[model samples]
Target: MNLYAIFAIYFLMWVISAFIMLPFGIRTPDETGEVLLKGQADSAPSNFRPGLVMLRATILATILFGLYYANYVQGWVTLDMLPGYSAAQ
Candidate 1:
């Protein structure tokens, strides 16, 4: 893949990883035995750590993208392997 394609894929992977990592390690105020601030939603996390989340997301995205890139280069799986796929022209 080209540089732009790789960058785009990595960016997409990072965003996906960020969202996938968001729900984990969250602590609602009720769960943490903390009083909710004014205008804070009941489900709002009391100990939300953006830095940790970003770090974890980066790591997970790197691993995921690495596997994807390897598969792309190795052709371990391909569209032709999917059921019902047809490449006839």
Candidate 2:
């Protein structure tokens, strides 16, 4: 629940999320013929790929950061303690 831990988790999650989404943006699109419909996104593998990638990456980063931040402030999730140390049975 400390600020240090929160910051660490946020930073770690952000970097990881950004890196993961980076690949989706870096992939080049093909010139294959496809049917286009109205109101559909035109994400061709062109110069605009990187920008779209960045946008997605940022959104993913936000989500990751939020999850990490929440987890950081959450209660205990482990119970590894043992019981019954008596000698007589």
Index of the highest-TM-score prediction: 1
Runs in model 2 deviating more than 4 A are: 1-9, 25-48, 76-89
Error of 1 at 67 (Å): 0.7
Task: Show how many residue pairs clash in every candidate, following the order shown.
Answer: 0, 1
- In the range 1-89, model 1's lDDT, one tens digit per residue, is 99999999999999999999999999899999999888989998888999999999999999999999999999999988888996663
Reference-based lDDT, each prediction = 0.94, 0.59
User: Candidate 2 overall Cα lDDT vs. reference?
Assistant: 0.59
Candidate 2 lDDT by residue in tens digits, 1-89: 67797678666766776678765633233444555456545664443465666677668877877765565457333233225444344
Backbone clashes, candidate 2: 1
For each candidate, give its TM-score against the true structure.
0.94, 0.46
